[model samples]
Target: MTDNQGAWTLGCYGNPDIRTPNINQMAAEGIRFTHALSSNPVCSPTRATFLTGLIPSQHGVHSFLDPKYMMGPEAYNTLQEFTSLGEVLHAAGYTCGLSGKWHLGANMTPSEGFTTWTTKPDGSTQEFYDQKVIENGQMRVEAGYTTDFWTRKGIEFIQACKERPFFLFLAYNGPYSLGKLMLNEARNRHAAFYADKPLHSFPRDAMHPWQHDNKAFHNTDAARRRMASEVSGVDDGVGEILTALKANGLDDNTLVVYASDQGWMGGQNGMWGMGDHFRPIGAHELMMQIPFIFRQPGAIPPGQTCDALVSNYDFMPSVLAHLGLGDKMPQQPKSPGRDFSPALRGQPLAGWDNTVFYEMETTRAIRTERWKYVARIPSGPTELYDMQADPQERFNLFGQPGTEETTTDLSKELEAFFDEYADPKYDIWHGGGSKAKRHAP
Candidate 1:
């Protein structure tokens, strides 16, 4: 979840058929959001939204921005501008710690409220690599698997602040291997487990034509296997963190959250990765829908599921509400996301709108309880699908007869949503650099 590295291939939610036990166990014990999504489809934008509880338009981080954008005058001042969730928690008398990928700004130090911090440099491999920690304005490097290292740092923070409440953001970069070593391991495992069936056969209910393209994966059965293995590895890491929390006696009071930055395509739509929306071999559920689970024992009932639509943008506000500091937090002027803590507790969310808005560069989508509207900007060719009927989003019903009223209504909703929530300046700036300019009408 740290980097925009291998999001698509790792099955950010879960390959139900592939059966990741760790993820499955978590789903069984906690709530699983089937309609959760990131505010943006890429790395930096999504991270920014989660940290600040604002939309990308409000944050002016429509895409990945490097140090130049972070520091330069014309580039956009990301640092020293937006308030982070860490800062909010720190303000409310909670010690904060962050471990894992910090792609928001180049510097690893807590830029917000992390009393303790450890992070890997951007573009690093997903292996257990050396980490650079920033403590009291000082930097130090240590060696370990990235996931394990983050968990260790988090446990240390919990021990150090046993009396005082704390907030730990343990992000991981797993199941997203760039090289073939991990991929081969996954493939071998799959071959051994599912050797009787053809590895690349399309799912029976596959809605997208691209899902059947064997040539897209070409020679990547090993890659698929590796992806599955890495996901299992991440699940193991999550289990370890959960065990540590319970062992430390913090599980009862502490709120634990598990989610991915975004979904990955992973050869499900004839594509191996994400961030290629222009060519868009796949942006179906496999590439966008993410898995979100929160466990706050006693506070949030065990084994509860809420279908209320949510996204990363709601993360900060939700956390602030959980800490009883929602009143003190500054109102996010441009964020449409509301706190979902009540809904998570199995209480009916009165007036709760079940719509999640999503955008990635020129691509924009609005998912309601039953319908989905997706548009690729600059060309204005929109896609409309009834999720209840076709969750895969294969059939485009724009300009079709008898559905004109539905299309008009949804398009109007999307337009108003964009007008009020979307940032035109960021769109104009970032959309020009995008490879695809076609807009969904």
Candidate 2:
């Protein structure tokens, strides 16, 4: 996954501005989810949701794992609460290796059934190339471009386990940094690619909450260029991995899936670098909606696109079905996500709901194909937008005479959807008012 990244508005999805040949090639050779969303719009929470087919509330990874959010090692619930992709697949005899960005805590040691583990500490980047990675619980600084390094490790794992099925969670830490600084090698290659590109024009009332976070905060011309450069570096890494897959004759058999954690606010809404859940910006569609591509050669049809709504949580169940281990998942509460395999096959499953739900901290929002409603607790300054018209969410139509019925209905659905989790804290209406303090497990 391209952690802290976006693919929707990129050249791969529709935008012709950005050049991502490898990402575009992946889509051309496989299926792309047009309406895919990160369950939670933060790194760790969304990553946790990717591993466990549950939202942040269920998985107990409410935000990025760090001192600002979690207190200690025991605070992370990745091990105790839900089944992880690694655990389930590893148990099923599939070799599972996680190479980068284990933001769910316990970074040094293997957890969640990953026998082959390597990652760095939370929120520490000693520069993109020179960052320290913990390999098999051993700490060492890795040299060279980080994006390339992870891909190299991924190739090694693939080569080592060529005789068997393996799940390689290659989370690229590039294309997501928060500053103009980049590894010299990566910067040299990408520094001038976007020199002629224009700066993003922001909305008049756009939310620019932080000025110091320049990398993505204001998204100046320099920032955008750097962001694009980083993306190119990641693209090169992907191309390398793809090359290795083909060279090892694992291209057709291996389902190469690529996605990212969440979209950054790079110059959008006059904000940069912050995820949508950050205050004032609320849960914007740009922040939650991410680029999701799945490539399986003859398995998944090529050059196809699925617009049906899917989330990071849907990946686990889908993978289970793909591996013929669907029934192995312990029966618990009904899963929040559907097996989108049908969508991948261009077969529309029954009851295809194209609605999207988003939540972070005290904010909750529901977005339909044409409309979106955002409310933040007791006093949120509710927001409603006709997405068909105000795709940018520039205009708010909440409390307007014509929106009363739709607003009421969507509000109820949003509240009920949250209530289905059985956790009052996320109920959107009653959760915050519960007698017991609302804290994730």
Candidate 3:
């Protein structure tokens, strides 16, 4: 995200439905993990995991910050509790810079590992055209779309930092939440996208923000088209960045990590809005499974696909190991995410557990090779799906007789996984009690 940039479709994510050539090219040039999970299906928390290699429960940010603080310096200060990848890489002599979609923390000052920062402070909280950005704390509206603006700025950082190794965390806020923010408005509008079906057909009322901005989008074809356009724009930006890398001769050495903090639900699962009590959380596969692509010239074999379980939390450790700085980085005891660098290089780690655990408030899920078991705290309506048999998840085999043993086993493993990393104060499943408990301010 940065906003609601969902993986609507790309040939790589088993969706031969929509076209995303630039991203698809990256997949062809690297390894694509079929089962990459997001720690949480939201913006800030998942972004936090990228830097800490820990899920939101361990990193402290459980939900996206309130609008009053999402862009201010307070958000940055709030994230100081964890040791960031920036501090780790910056300490190792890497020039760190960030451009675009700085929703993880305070967007104003150059904090964290980035000494160079550019973002949307001058512009209102959404959109891609004629926008203003605060560059290194100074406000200025650049003459371009936001995605293009970030691509240029990222290229600038790459060209300027030729003297040293650099880590450019370029995040774009796009398909602008809901895919209907014109070329501008980029706030809650981003999450308004829905599949090209009747919104009324779903089981529940759409949790759209203000009737999807009072538009007749209501799960119309127009909404999907707008979302597709926004994704196309992001693809163009990706092309530009890869071109810039080739132009600057940094293509061979730099390791490219293409991933998303989380995914959005476009009218799937009887809900339009994402979860954590907003709708459904950790219940549908769409929200947790994100696009994970890795590209490195000779280190990782190109055009290969890996099915081992991976998640956003594992990125930090994998990146450090890939750069040969694994031993140098300090460990976060609360984080249970493992480094998949060996898997990326075509060597699966010894004793690799091919499973991933997920939670948002009281909603919990554990996904393995064939099963995806989802449960809630003190609950009813638990779901057990045979992912191998029914990828669409149309059937719930939870309480069925033949599936009882499998469901019970998954429940035990899910609890054990959370118990290992649960910090009562921050973990939504543990300290926060249940989903209903998250309704408070």
Name the best candidate (by TM-score): 2
Ranking by TM-score: 2, 3, 1
Model 2: per-residue Cα lDDT over 1-441, one tens digit each: 886676643677766656688888988998888888776667776787777777655555565665422224443434455677888888988899887777676566777877787666664344677677777667888876777778888888989999998989998876774644632333547666667777343222344543333433353455566667777778888888899999999898988888888876565666555443344534777778788898988788898998887778788888788668887664454557668787666677678788867766566778888888887766776889998999877778998888899999999998887778635443324543322123321
Rank the candidate models, highest lDDT first: 2, 3, 1
Which runs in model 1 stand beyond 4 Å of their true positions?
1-19, 67-79, 123-144, 177-219, 275-283, 423-441
Q: List runs of model 2 lying over 4 Å from the truth.
A: 67-77, 124-126, 179-188, 199-219, 422-441
Residue clash pairs of candidate 2 = 216-272, 216-273, 217-272, 424-431
Q: Give the Cα lDDT of each candidate.
A: 0.62, 0.70, 0.70
Q: RMSD (Cα, Å) of candidate 2? A: 3.6
Clashes of each: 20, 4, 14
**Which predicted model would earn the best lDDT?**
2
Report the Cα lDDT for residue 327, model 1: 78
Tell me how far candidate 3 lies from the true structure as C-alpha RMSD in angstroms: 4.9
Residues 276-301, candidate 3: write the lDDT tens digits.
42433445777777778888888888
Q: What's model 3's TM-score?
A: 0.86
lDDT per residue (tens digit) for residues 1-441 in model 1: 433332222232433435456556665666666667776666666777788877766666666555443322433326357567778778878888876666666454456887677765452353444555444445666665555666677677777887788887777766554433443444323336643323343232233333332333434555555555556556666777777778888878887777777665654434444543435423455555566777777777767777778888887777678668887556645567688878667787789888878776556777788888777657755678888888766677777788888877777887777678655555542443321222222
